[model samples]
Target: MPLQRDASPRMASMLLTTYRALGAAANPLLRVFHRRRVKSGKEDVSRREERFGRASVARPQGRLAWIHAASVGEANAVLPLVRATIERGFKVVMTTGTLTSAQVVAQIELEGLIHQFVPYDTLPNINRFLDHWQPELAITVESEIWPVMITELERRKVPLIVINGRMSEGSFRNWQRVGGLARSVFGALKMVVAQSDADAERFKRLGVASAVNAGNIKFDGKAPSFDPEAVQELQQRIGQRPVWVAASTHPGEETQVLETHRLLTRAFPTLLTIIVPRHPKRGQLIAEEIAGFGLSVAQRSKGEEITPDTDVYLADTLGELGLFYKLASIVFVGGSLVPIGGHNLLEPAQLHCAIISGGNTTNFAAVYRQFNREGGALKASNPVELAAAVERLLNSPEETEQLAVKAAELVAAGAGALNQTLEALEPFLRQETSRQRTKGEV
Candidate 1:
């Protein structure tokens, strides 16, 4: 698809202005404080730059298939694809936007994979990045469509594809308002592989002609391999207590979860609630909040042992979701309770934890919608409903087991998307190999 020549300049200007305004409005107070600290010499920019340079250069590259994921969620979604790409004998270059995601990727010990911060979306920076390690093909794990980067890639004639492509209803409406400008931007891509039919249709409306519904890549993610000895140790430590995990919970949602925990404790005396905040910084805050509930809480950070009387367990660490999911009976996928687009419910589903979510799951709407239809998940709209659902499941062993089985089955059925995605990429890979061969002869 070629860029739309008829895109209105006025509409483009309007769209840019709107984005700037939104950015200004949504800028975090923490970012402002961080900037002030850097300006005041409390933080060393030079050291930061040096560290980034070292990390970037450490990345090994050769006939690499590069994938860019904007954050931790998107980064995790690419794991299956990364493994498949590596198995097919292509070195994988995975780029992410956040330090946490980078750290997580670093810990993975992927033999043929490298992690790097994606260059800023400017032509010079992108070109510098491309020059360091030329990729055979570039795939972006969700909707990270930066015009300057895409245009540069197009100029270099690099093959680019958008995998697990999703446009939120809110994003779709905003793109509709910009008309052909959005269309032209999406048109630059070689293909758009959507997570759902709705996403495909939305891309079509935006003039993305080469779009296909390939399902979500997250659905193809395998449960993180757990050490049997470690699982047995944790299980023995956890005893016969009924444990519910609130995974990837956000700020306001944590308080709601704590309150729900208090309500449920009255019914099931041995019920243990595990709260894993989406941001680890909130661990201390969540601990304080749980204490304010007048309940004795155990902190994973403090290495405290959980007792029968312990009301809440605060998991304040990173990259131990495999352990948490293994211990949980019913897991509430957070970020859904509040409006912070839902976290990955598939993680818990793959681990065979009975899945529960709230209504505000716009980010993974298609995935959750399918899970709900498949009888693999339960939806709760409020704290009371969440508590009731938890209580019902905790009291009924048969129902809980049935839900977990169904959820795991749903995940198993969805695992072939990775193979499908790879099949779609074979042509581009062959084309790139042919180009390299011709260049070698010359």
Candidate 2:
């Protein structure tokens, strides 16, 4: 809701009150929506109550820090923070919105970390969640500016800080249009630790009292992990084949990738193109697309083994991008080709794959710019360009290795953000520790 003209405080309250009432009234409809998602494999049926703020496991005995990360990317960025918080004597409960994110978090089993599906933003859900956890303070990772949660946290006097905060241009413009409402929500934040100066400035303009640029925490993250034995098995299966990977591809980009694969095969006859979709559920459709191109394809999800005749290998499984990155020396990070910002490049960079990306990486403007400037990654504006980049890299293995080294070096140099974030979070964590000790929670 846009805050009405004249910026009356009463108007903002009325709008929020109306929002809460509407959410309360839609309880039944929301249940139906949740059921539909479960049937579609979007929600975990066993843990459906978690979506309504019902806790499946009992809250632990110590002072708890609640972290809400909207999806995998944000979750990955905050992992180091989660570990550091645990090391500093705090139990952490991390929430993520998607099923895939829950799966990813499950794979990375940390001792003091608890994973829960994020409660819906309705007042009832938020209140129940906060009541059950009784968290010392709440933290959000990157772009998770839920208005109701912020408002409720403010009412309860729980400090809510945003780590690795990011504000995209389009989002900033939308918030600017509803200036007063934006102010009401953002003003409740204790602090916003932004990824870039531009993002910090944008948060400040939106009425966050404190916004600091702490750099992107993803840079300090370890590369996606894989079973080395799985990598070795795949290497044996792919022996002597020229392999190139298209990782985390989106729908529109995959069509182009299939075409590029078709073209790449003409020059390098033994080419093995691997496509890992951003959503693994799209694997079946992508496998069909590969077949429509009149190429032999094997889908990893179906336990199909890669064969000499296979032109494309659809790596549709989750938490295995590291395996594919290890197999392919040349990699193209996806979601950039069709203006969907971009996926994480640090994964390939850390895994020592020569990285290539589409031109639309506004979501990671600073890092992508530095990558291009340092010859750490190549930019392909379209499918034709992507094909050429792959062809060129395939012909020059030494150049590909050099690019990989440059990217990995750039990443190593960018590794201190996690330390800086921990330092910034020290004040809040310490205060909570002291208070919890008084209450016998420490």
Candidate 3:
């Protein structure tokens, strides 16, 4: 028998070829995928064609800047950059992969910006997308190095820059196994303005020569906008009750949150635990799960009103984390407990929520560690520890207030990444402008 082939060598190239072939085969199947997503309220039926690399609207004329952000978090992180690029005289066509991100973009009021769905990364899809937009340059947000897309950008000589570049050690190690493909693909990037020195070093180790630390732009993110009137109304309704939030939680993590609630309720009888699932579509299922825990739950999406007897409130709505953050001083930012690499801690920190996180936060390792060391946030390795953390906050109002203040101070101190990233991109912006001037298109 032939020796079992080692799949490590040339694995990246092999994967890319298989990826494009699968994408080609997925073309017709996309309709079925879209239908299922639409039915589940995950896809926008009106803008489905955009996924096929078909332009929904005519591309704006002259000096177009194409920005791709994978989802809501990345899209939100790049908003300031998008606006700044527009101010610098480029028509930005921003692309996001998910419906929630599309809605997030729709909510923003940027005049020089147009939002579209990112095309599938098949050769035909990529070709069609490039032919129409013909962007002067491409900018992608944190870790969005699509191989096919990068190859196309290089072929067109459209310089690609990845701002706020991030690479986890696990990802770096995986890429290193196929160093040839990593180098060939990363070699095309004009620069990767990374979030931290560790991230920059990881990218450099993977053959990104121009990768440099620029801090994390999320520190500069605006405090999430919330309707004050709505917050006031909710406050009036809830009266004076002990409250906490388990926010941006993924599936398996909610069990831990529920257990924490169960333990906390013994001490604070009227304790209210508000769970904000990462995907709002799971509102009903989560609501049912809460009910199964012998907790009276109300879901915001279903227009269910919170009652005095309600033990849990499911804020299963969009763009409302700010509102929930204001209602509670104690918050457990989720995706940490179940090894999902954690969710953003900056949001809660910005709002002065005394933060609690779990052992895992590889997605935001640098920031999380900083927060933990400075007491800007508390870490709870298990469900029992989670309950203990919340109880600690509940028992000492002064400590809770101090921790919240410390976290907010840390967030403010972590600012300046936005300026650094803008500075890094200034050279490329000038080059694109000069090229346009040469072509008499400026």
Candidate 4:
């Protein structure tokens, strides 16, 4: 059903014009930031035919569904769903906005799954995309509501759903200002499975009454497997030393973490800080930054071994967070300390590592708030607090172990969301299957 008859043309035009201006500003900035993706062979520029209704295309022998996530974090949350979809005999096309996410999905090695760079959300591009892929159903992960894309999907009569949907308070305020136009976009989605009741209520305000409180799918992901031999080697190399990790550190946050590392090393002389920057390109820059701090730094990419006297070990490589998280007794999730809305704390939690985060976790506020309430995680307001949390966790091994166990249990309790989300998707999946059969694609 279209929204209540309050979608005035003047209002819609005003909203869209604002969106256009924002897009105009954002495009150049994003292009600059993602230049590495464009320069490297990682990104594909060729426009592929849509999933169906193209004369020269090869249609799938079975059913097909499309899942789109904005980046690595969102991509990780959708893995369980992707695996379940394939197990249920649906050909899944997973699309991500970043080169890093594309690489991660490729590594998943799911048989019936294909990974692609999501087409830009413009009329001709989206039309070309939809006309070719002709996905039976579309699922978007986490707050990606592209107007043209949603409108095109609606026009083609494809059922569109959003999984793990979230609207931060800031975003909600912006959308509220747009009024009816925003409501129309929200109404376009068939269903919204949100991470929390707070998020669901926000969607409700945007006119999406069908929003359901689905627990975060990030909590549902299985812990990454670590190489036993590698673990044995690393453990032997750093025996009896207290180790902590600062995982997925961002630009400004890395320096803060390094300062904290500097402060802690004075007391626990044998302490080791493993720093993993969110971007691989920033690894060298981080090495230089730490070098300026007058600490001996070893780079993982250079195959430099962390000596007993080494103060900092830079795990600069990509996709090895599992390894580092596995080694650490305590983890400080970065990006949060500096207002970047935090990265997934659940990853370290799954590995039974005591977790600490900064105060600015708006991106996953509900999840972190729940963890904080359960005593499964700690929050640090600034560099001083962050350093103290690390020092405190390191000095008290028993408390660290207890906190880690609680964090693990909390994550385990949240594991069934993927199954629930899959169950809720059944009706829509059935409809898509029926449509595909009638169109002779099955």
Candidate 5:
């Protein structure tokens, strides 16, 4: 629902009330949508009741801090903060919207962390979630602004912090149209720790008074982990072939990657190209596209083995990007060829892989620019450039190694955001700890 005009103070208040009422009234419709998603394997079938604010696991004792990350990327980006919260001796309740993120969280061996599906933003649902958890503070990562939930949290006086907060140009423009509603949702935030100065300023203009510029928390996230045995086995199977990976690729960009692979194989005849799509569900479509290019495809999701004849290895499964990043010396981070902003660059860089990307990386623009200046990444604005760059890197092994070293150095230099963020959040954390001590709950 669109927010009405904020011409006057009373009108703004009325509009906020109306928006909440409409959201609560749409609960039945949301339920139907959830059912459809469950049928399509998007939502976890057995965990459907969690969407209605029902808890699958009992809440642990003591002060619980709730961290809500919308999806996989957000969930990954906020891991540093989650770890910090746990180390401070607070029980952590991590909530995310996508099943993929839930799976990712499940794989991570973090103690004192509980994963739950974030409930739909209706009044009753919000109340149920709040009552069950009774969390002392709530922190939201990125730009997931849920109105009814914010209102309920506000009413309950739970401290809200938005960390690693990002406000893209498109989102800022959309929120501008609903000035009052934007204020209503953001006003509840005690503080917004932004990824960039631009985002901090934007949040202030939109009604968040306390938007502080902290470096992107992804910089402080743990390096992608891999299984040693699996990596060794895959390395043996590939057998000294020239290997490269194009990771988190979007729809139209796969064609460019496939073409690039075809070109690279000319220089290094036994070259193997791995394409890890952004969405694993699109694996079959991507395999078909690779086949259309007359390339032999081996899909990881289908248990297809990567053989000598396999031109392309499709790492189209969830939670395995680390294995592929380790397998390849040169990595191309995708979502940049087309206008989908861009994906994270630190993962490959942290793994000491030389990085390449297309020019449309408005998201993570600062990180990409810094990496390029540091000789850690190469830019390819078009398909020809992409293919040429990959081929050049493959031929010059020493140069590739130098770039990988620089990339790792850059990643290391960008660390410490986690420490700064923890310092910034210390006040709230201390307050919650004191409250628990006073009540003898800690």
Candidate 6:
């Protein structure tokens, strides 16, 4: 059901007034935030200037389309769209907020694509950024709603579209309390193309008249590419060991994975567990924890050898999930185990791995619904269940292969989101060539 619009004059005025006041202090507030983030190793210290609207690269002369994805997940989801935009002959400037995202984008090597750290959302920073890039069209991916940035884009008459837009029940409820503010922020968007019907309805309730369901683009995303030689080397090293990978794991979830490995190894004897933490910075600490647990471990970052005795392979590197997924027959998509919502299940699924996940997947409810319906994925609420699921797959290669086949088939069935999203956004995209030269014209 759509939400009732908050049309109270007092609420509208208060929301606008509050934002304007915050705009005045945004510069100082952002500087303090950046300092803290840098000190805590959240922000890249050398590239910190980019967060203040400073350009790290020169802007192209041709018409540019700007797309912003908040971090690695959002960045990956927007890659196909970025490729489509480049194929349209416009220079693409992609901005993201995390170091991991920056690293991942660097490996993509897409023509006409440039990645930058997004500027802080303040009036001054927004103005400086807009003036420098001067993008004719702006696309914000997922649910990164930056009020000041949207307000500036609206003021500058840039056509703004929110692609793959999502609003969870929890987020919708929070937005309801500040309905007027939500209206102001969401109102700046020319269109909000949601990933699911539920999200589209939520946008409509929040006063987004142009909300449309374009399907989830993650399903349309290209599978992660891997280096052939690297994959071959890793495969040779593993020999005939039973392998399972727990990928994109968060902080507390690592402990659960470690415990699950203990159970699996007891049954399989030579079972190899690979853990790829979401953040590579935690590599050293994770290695220490493995050693403390008396498990023989090898760190990928350190180029440690994965011998027969290596119980855990700490794939603490970036841009190699595809390699690990290909080597492992069963994959546990992490983050779901500890209420961090879930990481992308499609990655491993598309790579032909049997998928197992935890019970908490509110962020990807729609995707999970289809997976459950098709029996393409298994769910476990705790370490014991997780171990059992892995053990079952390891013991039964035929069952694992069947699950893998179903997962790949499921992904193949939902591969038209890119064309659908482009069809919906064609009007805005066409505006970019409105002033193009004719065949014989100079």
TM-score of each: 0.85, 0.93, 0.93, 0.89, 0.89, 0.93
Q: Which residue pairs in model 4 clash with each other?
A: 50-132, 50-133, 51-132, 51-133, 52-133
Error of 5 at 149 (Å): 2.1
Ranking by lDDT: 2, 3, 6, 5, 4, 1
lDDT of 3 by residue, 1-442 (tens): 1112343437666876787789888888887887898998888889888888999999887689999998888888899999889888889999999888888999988888999899887788888999999888899999888888998888888889999998987788777766767776887788899999989988877767798898999999988778889888888878899899999998888888999999998899999899998889888889888989999998999898889999999999988999999888899999899878888899988888999999989888989999999989999988899999999999999999999999999999999999999999998775654446557863
Q: Which 10 residues in a row give candidate 1 its minimum summed lDDT?
A: 46-55
Model 6 ranges off by over 4 Å = 1-7, 23-26, 432-442
Looking at candidate 4, the ten consecutive residues that score lowest on lDDT are: 47-56
Candidate 1: regions farther than 4 A off: 1-55, 58-62, 86-90, 433-442
> Candidate 1 at 155: error in angstroms?
2.0
What C-alpha RMSD separates each model from the true structure? Answer: 4.5, 2.8, 3.6, 4.0, 3.5, 3.1
lDDT of each: 0.77, 0.88, 0.88, 0.80, 0.86, 0.86
- Compared with the true structure, what per-residue lDDT tens digits does model 4 show for residues 105-220? 87887788887678666555567667667788899998898887887787777888999989898888777776788776777888899888888988888878599987788888
Lowest summed lDDT across 10 adjacent residues in model 2 is found at 1-10
Model 1 agreement with the true structure over 80-99: per-residue lDDT tens digits: 77887787778888888766
Please identify model 5 stretches exceeding 4 Å from their true place: 1-7, 266-269, 433-442
For candidate 5, lDDT tens digit of each residue in 232-337?
9889989988889999998999999988887777788898989998878789989999999999999999999889999999999988889988889999999999
**Taking the tens digit of each residue's C-alpha lDDT, what string does model 6 give over 218-282?**
88888987888988999999999989999999888888999998887789889889999998888
Question: Least lDDT summed over 10 consecutive residues: which range in candidate 6?
Answer: 431-440
lDDT (C-alpha) at residue 278 in model 2 = 87
Question: What lDDT tens digits, residue by residue, belong to model 2 across residues 1-442?
Answer: 3333555567667767888888878877889999999876788989988988899999998778999888888888888888888887888999999998999899887888899999888988988999999888889988888888899988877789998888987888887776767889999999998888888998998889999988889998888888989999999999999999999898889899988887887898899999999889889888888898898999999999999999999999998898989888899999899888888898899999999999989778788999999999999988889999999999998999999999999999888888878888899977753445557853
